[model samples]
Target: MTAGVDTGGRAPGRPRSAHVDEAIIEAVLGLLAEGGSVETLSIEAIAARAGVGKATIYRRWSGKEALLVDAIASLKGPPPEPLGESVREDLIRLLSVGPKKPDERTAQIMSCLVPEVQRSPERYRLYQGLVEPRREVMRQVLRQGISSGELRADLDVEVAVAALTAPVLIQRMLRWHPGLDDESLPARVVDTLLAGLAH
Candidate 1:
């Protein structure tokens, strides 16, 4: 029998063996969440968990860094839609929804990357490519609020964007908290931030 043979047989939309590609991604994510840093993440481990061969993973990624970069890039969700309300409300909505357990693997990788971001310009650029678009989405929403007169025209949208996200990030990165208390965190952030921006 083939190494990846489907003894149970294949179905429509399913690969002959398991879908090696998806398994690879899942395996990588699991490792990352399990406190495996980029340096610590091994291709062998990924292949083992994925139930795919080493060559299969290698055929897709040039190296561990490249594989990690792709995996991390895929993990992000698109920027959220703006809620129909005041800037404070919208911000609350934005920050309220986030990873419940958070990805420990990604966290470990990022912790390592943060300090080296300056030293590795290309790596930092890759990070920005994945993360910046999300920030821009927030910026656009804030700008729209300003134009619609929902928020003060004098508001520094960029600064406000940071203010909206900073606490959430700090809590996750520093304390390793799971998801935020949606009922309170978002509302509190909105209230405090709007106090500075509301005209």
Candidate 2:
């Protein structure tokens, strides 16, 4: 029941059903959860899993890559909308809103996709398309901090964003630490970066 894929524009046929869309996406995730990769995934299998025809999926997406991209994007939902009230608070909010629980299925899906995306340039670009907009949200917050003189005037926004976000993402995606559920971790990360970046 995450967001559905954007069909871009209307096609000259029956309108797309949100129910069918969710079924297709869930089918993709279900397969990935069972250890399927992009290489191993096929439209035929997805159609069967979703209880739809191959033409149904084709009507929604061009191929497996496009369908997979939309499915993964749905998993992420949407990025947090940053409040303009305070830079530190906004950054913390963005960093804190991710899978805090031990979701083996999500972790497994990521593990399956990360390497495969890295190896394929097309997949890498599609993945970047999904990630960069979220990163840009953080960049905009950093720029606002600079404008308000809340952060160092010479602060490199990209580096500041990376420093602030990397640790949290590493923990959430890779589970490198024992504190995935640590609610205070976001504030600590923001404060630590601010100590160096704050004006």
Candidate 3:
């Protein structure tokens, strides 16, 4: 739910470039894509990749774990308010969320992070901080639809939400199906499910 993080709290020094923050995050993600294991990744690697001094990174983050958290969290944008009163309209909006730019790096970061997050509590905590709130909103929207009789009275909101999200995650993120990653995909998925679930 929180977006637009506080920009203050930097180490006492000359002001840092807003671009430096981005470059450090880009470095972390880039290293992650190259399979930067704990044994291999270090402050030196990130600083070198980001084209900055170690102090520049340290100025913003206390250490690697803190830096990684900030990097992953930045990939997730602020959750948008549900756009429509109807369940179908809202589902379409929620499911189409992604970067405005055409880049594979964001997906690549997620592809790498999904499994790694499980073993690292630090990573899991940081990943969940961005994911859990958005899921809760989807659940709320489904429940409201059910109560209003827009959806099946017997519809399980939990199952519905999973049904709503799983295809996009699986095909887009897990399986890497090229055909399924189009802009129309969200609408198509929602329509298919709503036809069966809507009363």
User: Which candidate number has the best TM-score?
Assistant: 2
In the range 117-186, model 1's lDDT, one tens digit per residue, is 5667877786776668778878887898888888888988778889888887766555445565534666
Report lDDT per candidate.
0.66, 0.82, 0.74
Task: Tell me the tens digit of each residue's lDDT in model 3 across 1-199.
Answer: 1123334346666776778888988898789877776446799999999999997777677778777766766665557579657998899888877554325666666777777788878778867777777888898888888888888888877788888888876655555677665567779889999887456
Which residue pairs show collisions in model 1?
32-105, 33-105
Judged by lDDT against the true structure, how good is candidate 3?
0.74
How high a TM-score does candidate 3 get? 0.80
Off by over 4 Å in 1: 1-19, 59-63, 83-86, 101-113, 116-119, 176-183, 197-199
TM-score of each: 0.72, 0.88, 0.80
- Which candidate, 2 or 3, would have the higher TM-score against the true structure? 2
Instruction: Tell me the lDDT of candidate 2.
Output: 0.82
Clashing residue pairs, backbone N/CA/C < 3 A, model 2: none
Per-residue error at 53 for model 3, in Å?
Answer: 1.9
